[model samples]
Target: MNTNNKRIKKGKVKKKKRIRISRLILVLVVLLVIFAGAGNLYYKSASKAVNDKSTKSVLIEVPNGSSVKKVAKILKEKDLIKNKSVFISNVKGNEKAKHLKAGKYKLAQNMDNNAIIEKLIKGEVYQDGVKLTIPEGMLSTEIVNKLVSQKFGDREKFVKLYRSPKEFSSKFSFLKDSRISTLEGFLFPSTYYIKKGETEKQIFEKMLLEFQKEYDKKVKSLVEKNKLNLYDTVIMASIVEKEAVNDSDRDIVAGIFYNRLDKKMKLQSDAVLQYGLPERKSRVLYSDLKVETPYNLYLHEGLPPTPIASPGIKSLIAAANPKKTDYLYFVTNVDGKNSYSTTFEEHSKNAKKYHQERNDLLKENSSEKNKTGNDENDNKEKSKEKTTN
Candidate 1:
């Protein structure tokens, strides 16, 4: 009884141990397969997310009547997704492969594989979206910031180029130091669509081309009539652009600036002072008069060295053909929108009034901007005002 009982117990124990071992092995195999599948899926998803389509393209050009296979190859070439073979397989397996239309596709990083594929097959055509609405009379630095925020170009690089425009002028033969120091006045304010990550060279070419076209359309004939060169036109246009905030005032402001220039009086334009300020100043200080910069129209008998800001079409035309007026002085009034004054005394009184008005406007602007949570920009502007005042 004892031997048989002991043998039965040992057998039962062996059977239980074998069952436990088998269950453990089966669980490990399942876990291994699951982990492998998960790893593969993650790898594919991540690869698709980071791999940008066609150098961060806003559009992917698909030739007309291109086959599914051809589109897959193009996507692969663009580094948009993985496995052209796999993509082709998906398309062929898709219920609508035969209906796959072709055209330009706007794509971005982080678009999943299926989303991009659907967009391409649906003939979604969206070219590089670079909509920029440039205002008249913005400083070069402000322009740079706007461009940088829009992701068209690097702000730091543009700033560096703006600071040293002669280097760029050599590259673009049309511009000289006198006409546009660092391409400031020649940028030609307008709504521009420049591709993101575009090279500085490309952006410059686009802007320069725009300026050239504008000159041809608006100012070329007048330049001939007035015996003015491109340089003079741009310089005058810059002043007009700065002074003429409202569209209707462009011609009238041009008349005033031209009259002052012809009379050999200091332009005494606060706009020029604002433009020339690096750190930004609140008011044009007495010491700012002797700032020894070519842009200091207060010291220079003639025009400032170059345009302070990129001029628009209206300003360009106004520079070429100023309205007939005997007014020697003009001052932007308390609103910072309109002006008041003709004689020196009137101008001085307006300036004094605007001094407080401008300060209040600046402080108001600073508070509003800070309310929008841009304390850094507000502080920078305030610092600029302090330096100017």
Candidate 2:
């Protein structure tokens, strides 16, 4: 009887131990479920929009080389996100987090973390509705005037910004040259859509970026092959832009200038002289030639200090790859045709012929005007006689 009681007690103890173990496991499972639910709720709440019903838009800047943590901080400071930790976690999970670009972004309060992250990753920067068209061969001052006329930027600010090329040199490699003191010939002329509230520096950078693209495509290789100075080539192209009346004449004009440079002769470009004048004129006079400016090619044997104007792609190409020619002199006739000459004597003859032709045409037009006036007077006199009769 004693042995049977011992076995029954041992069985009861074993059953109790098993029941305790099962209860502990059940409690742990319930606790785990509760904690998981809480964690999921916290994640959803943290990742939710800051203001789902808000319609306000905020402009934020994500500066260059900003880390994910910095970006999250910027978002949190801007009130565009509900939680910085959640934002950082979300961005870290995304594969495109590394591609987040720096720029001004237009974000709305209603945007969620995912929406903003996607925008930053895709680099959808803020842009305005204003469209600006900068024409080729326009001076930098003229470009600024156009921008100012459109109420896009301040004149004084643009002037100061363009004069300081070093401010932009780090971003634009072409501006890295030490000799480039001003952003005169570098601003590429193209139609641009100005961003809303963009600074003058940003606006100029847009044009410079366009110039870089064009220079690489159209003129870079040719410039390299010819072993010419990039700045001087631009200066030559600017002269060609002003002097050439037609597309066909650009290459020839560029060649003539090159020949003169090789011979160490004066360029004697009227366009260069005209650029130095206070006001532009239809004809550059003998008195205008005496203007003692560095830009006066009549006095200077080499190119002017800076480009006279912005050059188009055609003029740039022509300067980089000019036509091979023996002719060094050219004159524009009254009919708008250019005559090329290899000798000064031939050039003088051509100039005299064109001058005489222009004078004769002017005299003929004056005589025709006088004849018409006299005929009108005669008709009035006949009418007066008829009235007397």
Candidate 3:
């Protein structure tokens, strides 16, 4: 009876152990399932696009020496990535991430991380057209040089085309003005994406079209209301673009020029004098102002015969609608800030103050340079003395 009872007890113990093992196995299986689902959800979220339905192309430039983290930040900022951490992890995991090139890339919002990484690694940069960025206040000759350097057209052909606005007058009505001889200010300074096989003439036409659009949008109504022709307004805008250092200053400078114009006072713009010179210098000498040219505002009473350089849209708007002020004269300081004055005596005082400040700055710079040279010589002498000793 005792042996049978002991056997029953052992059998019961074995059954309990089996049941506990089964429960442990079941718990582990459930945990595995939960973990698998969570991992799958994370993968789906990471792999998906920020906007799968949108087809808008965004241009992003990955500058030289940019790391994976920097590129990820750029993508995140551009709203091209769903998660920056996922992007970085994916990039680090991919062997091709090391091969990513620096350039302007045209990426779409529909692209996933894998697609973007592949594109960047393969260096599939935007090459749909030639990029031509003509900055504001560039002289026509400078523009011609830029085009020639880029192998856009022959120098002589570009120069000839630039001088003859009549060539493009048939297409652009703004060029119909009898006074419009050169296409200086009419080139419209802006970034242009020229087609692969476009000619110089077509390029010029594109710029002129842009100019027309901008002028009509921003300056046309104002010019018409002010009883100013497009030619004169563009000329003034060109001058304003060259003179003013900032936007607020642009309007005020335009006003000063208008005031001078109304009073029949000479514009006396150093920029105009510099424009008429054969070559541009860092500093325009007093003698340069005395040189006889239509563009020399000091010598000439009115606007230059042609616009000095390509006037940007802001300058164009400022010229059309100048800020009303009693200021007739302005003198720029060493830091590009202008001091405005309503009387000649006030203008003279401001000019003297700026001139003295500039002179003092120059002397200080010269003194620093001399001290540097003396220190270098002293170091050399000390080295020689030490070697001899």
lDDT of 1 at 260: 72
**Candidate 1, 1-389: lDDT as tens digits:** 79999999999999999999999999999999999999778656544644544356544788888887888778778767676766776676667656666666777655656777677667666645567777877766677788878677777778777666676566566676354547777776676667756787677667777888888887889878978777877777888886766777777787887777788776766677667767676445555656777677766667877677788888888888877777766656665576545676666666566656655665778665455443434543543343332
lDDT (C-alpha, whole model) for all candidates: 0.70, 0.86, 0.86
TM-score against truth, every candidate = 0.54, 0.62, 0.64
RMSD of each: 19.5, 13.8, 15.5
Q: What is the C-alpha lDDT profile of model 2 across 1-389, one tens digit per residue?
A: 69999999999999999999999999999999999999889888888888999999999999999998899899999999988988888888898777689988999879998999999999998865688888889999899999999998899999999899999988988887787888988888787888688899999999999989899999999999999889999999999998898899999999999998999988988788888899887566556666899988777888998888889889999999999999988888888779999988788778768766765675688875564443444443432322221
Q: Which candidate is the best by TM-score?
A: 3
Q: Which is better, 1 or 2, measured by lDDT?
A: 2
Point out where model 1 deviates above 4 Å.
Answer: 1-127, 159-173, 176-181, 336-342, 346-389
Error of 3 at 112 (Å): 11
> What's the CA RMSD of model 2 in angstroms?
13.8
What lDDT would candidate 2 get against the real structure? Answer: 0.86
Q: Which regions of candidate 2 are displaced past 4 Å?
A: 1-128, 364-389
